[model samples]
Target: MVRWHVWIKEHEFLGKKGTSQDGFRDLLRASPTPKAVTGRNLSSEDLSKSSLQGRYEISRYAPVCLWEEDFSEVKQAFDDLRNRGIRDFRRHFEKHPEEILSFAGKVKINDVNEYTLELYQAKTKEDLLKGLEIVFSKQSYEVFKEELIALADGKTRFMSEAVNRTLNGEQIHILLSLAVPPGYKESLSRVIVCITDISAKQRKARELERIGEKYRKIFQNAIDAMFVADTETGIIMEANESAGKLLGMSTIQMVGMHFTEFHPKEEREAYRSIFEKHASRGRSLSDNLLVCQRNGRKIPVLFSSSIISLDGRNYIVGMFRRVLSPDHAQRHARAGKSLVTERKVSSHAKERLSGREREVLTLIAGGMSNRQMAEILCISEKTVETHRTRVMNKLNLHKTADLVRYAIASGFVS
Candidate 1:
């Protein structure tokens, strides 16, 4: 690891450490909204306040070793443009009494050589630098460097707390947090530069909150109970208010409990198989075989799901609608689920089957016998059986009812 800067540790230049450091720096430099990562030009809706911590403090480390120091002992940053590159950077510190930097920069003049010490205050930055031209006549460079760092550190803390709470992707035009402390109370007399990426927990928390709100609207307003289960863990990740009512328990008592707990140990295997299939294959909406509810009642649930990302991990977001009585399907027709079901394709198995074979499968789902299908398609009964055999082999459906269900589910027919 080549040590280039005092604040930038040597590990930052190697393998995983390098990528991690780069990602973190990019994240901070990156806009907080989703659009930034997606490569979409950001509108005002997607914005976060990007600010500096405070006015810059330029300082040099005392007792500096050019080699082997992580440079954290003094809790300071360095000015390294003078060092120019890695080779020179190492020599500067190894030789002692020099500074190095990353993530921040300040103006420099040819004056203030390696051995001076000085410090002074000015009302404005312009005035400060302007006076530096003549005022150093009274001070040493070491004192000047310390006073500068202390002042800059004070500003850094305040700016860190200046928050940008983004709602959806709204454009934010707040103060630049650069070089400032977050608040008056948080002001520290001295602070070290923090350059790590530690913002995921907060950002992910906000994203999950947003998803909860979106799903809540649908679950609370929909005419059915909604349940979400984790495929890998087999735990109930989320369930809407109606889920408790459908499961025959109060909402408070039902949450934080596993879905499998309500089922017979034997039935869990079947449910797990289906869930894993959905998670791996990306099937969209599915309906009940059965999901046991509270009070030990097995209720038929119409299930639906979509793939979603949260906190940088993939999860299946789901909906569960109770498939009630005979009238429920009819009620759902008006509300949306039945109409959706009607569009199901019954012949997904025939998706890759030849046209002649598809004709046979469709006839089978339509309740036609082989002889009847052959007669209608103007083929011999033997040809109809051949097509049927091919269809079954491809779809792996040995039973007629399974063929009918597969067809209906994939919207194979109206």
Candidate 2:
């Protein structure tokens, strides 16, 4: 009778302890600092059911939690937990199996998702484009990609936030995440930006699209026979206004034609062979090409092709300008005449010197002193001077400075 009474009293005491909210508080107050402030509000995160490791193991005590004496009754109402795993009965009733599988991995998001950064001043969209242009416009994409990644890795001034005026006449914080993908530390840092206002992004995108459409209209109507060719295949994909005049067909018909069609009949094979060689090695090739005109007349043309990668495809942009030889020839003829005149003048100055004096004159023009010239020729400084003096008189150059200036103008220094 005494044992039965003691057991009944013990059960009643534990039942009351489990029912009280203050009971959990009392446990936390007892353990001064559980795991460096152990039983405190846990690492700020989404609510989960995992049993915490410290004094406050909420998952275990949840069964006897206030309104529910037995949580197992709420879930299984059957025997036990039985180490829930692959063959767990409670998990089998999940409405969508994939939804259960998704819980296996972390949600995986960048830390510090959004925050207010107090910039000294707010920047407009044009200001941002100017900064991006400094890296993208001059350098190739490959170089620019590496440069942005380097800046983000150092945590420099590249990544920052600012305030922007929202359409509602209020300021909102705009955040830019220069966050690397979790595992890709060595590759380029890709930024995923966040704006509090969704309408702002749509407005900017629409304005830019309008600008691109305007340029497209002009490109299609331009006078020059502009062709955007696939650099790898040499096939012309886009042809503009004057292409029809040259090919005796509309731009639609010429779209399927290869650039080799523009070559002369006999030189077609040889011309294509050289272009293939340059394209394979990623080199730009250009020459004065002869394109047979639509009227069966051969026209003299100057064509220049540059390799560009646009929309993830390599394209050869070819521009043709008619070469009026009378204009070009007159310019070339003048250039040739100047070349001969300079040569004659320089030749006359070189004539009044011995062979050894000419050697010293050549070295002096090459920006070498008497000592360097002597070292190169395996001769002494005194020997170099004797040669220099004789050459100076022959050239009427009294001062060394005058000799240098003459050498530059006469094309010897170059």
Q: TM-score for every candidate vs. truth? A: 0.34, 0.34
**Residue by residue across 1-414, what tens digits does model 2's lDDT show?**
000000111111111123225333222222333332444564423112122233344422322211111111212311222344324433342433332222212111111111211121214333432332231122122222332333323322223333344223354333322322222233222222222323366568778999777656655754445687886788989887766766567888789788888767888898788777766665544455677765656766545455667789877666554444455544544543433343334467655665456555545755667876564444699998988887776766666756655544444323
lDDT on C-alpha atoms for all candidate structures: 0.43, 0.45
How does residue 332 of candidate 2 score in lDDT? 46
Tens-digit lDDT track of model 1 for 1-414: 111111223212111111222222222332223435346565554333211111001112221111111222223233333344433433444355344222112323212211112112234334433543343221223333333353433323212211222222222122211122222113221122322222455578779899778656755554445555555665666666767666777666655666666556678877666678877886554444566755566766545566555666555665454444545434434443332334343445345766556545555755777765553444588888888778778877677766665444443322
Candidate 2, residue 131: Cα displacement in angstroms equals: 38
For model 2, the local distance difference test gives 0.45
TM-score quality measure for candidate 2: 0.34
